[model samples]
Target: FYSELLHIIGLVETKVGGKRLIERNSEGQRHSGTILEDTIIHLDSLDKISRLSKAFIYGETHEERLFNVALGLNITWINRILFLKLLEAQLITYHKGDKSYAFLNLNRIREYDDLNRLFFQVLAVKHEIRNDDVKKLFEKVPYLNSSLFEPTEIEHQTLFISNLKDEKTIPALSNTVLKDEQGKKRTGSLSTLAYLFEFLNAYDFSSEGSEAIQEENKTLINASVLGLIFEKINGYKDGSFFTPGMITMYMCRETLRKTVVQKFNDLKGWSCVEFDELYNKIEDKKEANEIVNSIKICDPAVGSGHFLVSALNELIAIKSDLKILQDKDGKLLKFYDVEVENDEMIVTDEEGHLFEYNPK
Candidate 1:
């Protein structure tokens, strides 16, 4: 059922120029018009895929299932091998002549299982490994030789990981044995370690939106949701939950906003305005940049470093905006220099810049 849905989605996406097919309404009426032209379009492609899979798995009648199957075939395929390419990219095997398909990366699934088991084992021994610790471990793992992260960022990450007090336990981590769901003893192998590293490299925790606030907030939500899912799966009954990104952003923004208003005292109408708007209204670009630079943010309960990360991003964004405003008015701001490489903007500002930017 899952395979068929993927094929269907791939077919529709190719036919409609990477747009997903519209779903049916409660009355069983298929949605009309192109995705963009329609009044409402589904943004959750993953959920749509799941629903399509469920329709085939537990449809009420043969016609209901056939309706979904027909939806898959409605598209006209100009590029017949597009679906095959999609399958290949997803690590799914496809036989062209026989039209057979299967998952090519069963080891990836096992890798996840191994990771979960490892996490439980770690919890048992160490109570909990801080998210930063987990991040450091990923940094130290030599398997991630790919250029997915910036050179400087990876170097710093590696250094931090190497300096960890428990760094010596990583090798033993892979070799640690634990009981499985069936109460059978299992030990993580070298292959499990390889898959774990691969998964970490592939998983992205950065924002990818044009709007800084929206993008960063979205990333926070995604990370928090994953944390929640992990907690639920592990049956964490401590009532400890991650702080939502929105609340963190709001708190950080408000803190910065109040500090700026208190110190500067030149800007008015800040109480009712957004941070970007308030920053834009400030005429002193240098002072604005200084204000942003001087403000120190700390999150004591820094689970996953979400608050700190978001605060750093927010500050950088403010500086970037101020720099842009300065540039437009032919004014020079002393604090930061912008370099453009490979059609991407790299801002080097202040002594400590958080995170590396690698735009896609």
Candidate 2:
């Protein structure tokens, strides 16, 4: 199944003139397909391309393919660099031999202890402030406003910073030293923060080229995929696996469909088994609005929040469909507003009422 999908993706790419690569079957037969010009494909389709390429060329299993794809695009490497940079700047500290640096008690840092915010500050100062200028920036750590160091347009800066801030608590190597048999000191590859930053800066995460495949679908590379990649790279001890978007979507849809049916049927005193039947039974727009708004979704073990995101998108879609039943006044129903707080999706109605979307 994986290999067949890979052949199709290669064919799709070639059809769109994305690459000169030719698609072939396992039996060494060339394969071809047609895709309409200017048609936008989703990121999931491209992910299949990455997965199949790894599996066919490297003999990687589905799990291995997912890990490799995640590692290639993960931004957690940046977090490690930022953490070490903060330590070098004396803005934070850890006990000797402690692999983790605790930000909860950093006295010098007065601003929000958000690692994402700190990274933005670093990017902002990377070019404009240097040498002795950095000393001044760190000297007033707690009072340092990242906004003061904005380097580009507000929209661009916001997108880049938000992307970086998607995941929390990336695995990083401890700065502790080791000695060989000859008593020579040895350190982890990531111990040197400067070298790591230099390497990371070479890859332009914000460039159109970096995200071209995803942008073709009017989306960006999944942050959850990147987070999983970082976990694999850092050798995360937990046995957690990255759930594919397709699986997440299916699970969310089925779960939400059942829940919505039950809730609506119970509310309207109707015994309907189908979602469409439930929708048709509920003639009151206000009642429908209440039912939609009251629905809360949670993913208890949310990692990278793929499930929650899928649920949110599904809910928004369901709400839009329900809007068709709205009267002329109900047509003024404001579009759903969504925000990401602490990596969870927070959706609200036009009246500014917040719906809970807890993913812990």
Note each model's CA RMSD in angstroms. 20.6, 20.1
RMSD of 2: 20.1
| Runs in model 1 lying further than 4 Å from the true structure | 1-191, 194-238, 266-283, 320-360
**TM agreement with the true structure for every prediction:** 0.31, 0.38
TM-score of 1: 0.31
Candidate 2 residue-pair clash tally: 3
> What is the C-alpha local distance difference test score of each model?
0.36, 0.41
Q: Give one digit per residue, the lDDT tens place, for model 1 in 209-310.
A: 223443212212133444333322122223345556577667766676566555555443345334455655677666666655666667675544556765
Off by over 4 Å in 2: 1-220, 230-235, 324-360
User: What lDDT score goes with residue 174 in model 2?
Assistant: 30
Q: What overall lDDT, based on C-alpha atoms, would model 1 receive against the true structure?
A: 0.36
User: What would the C-alpha RMSD of candidate 1 be, to one decimal place?
Assistant: 20.6
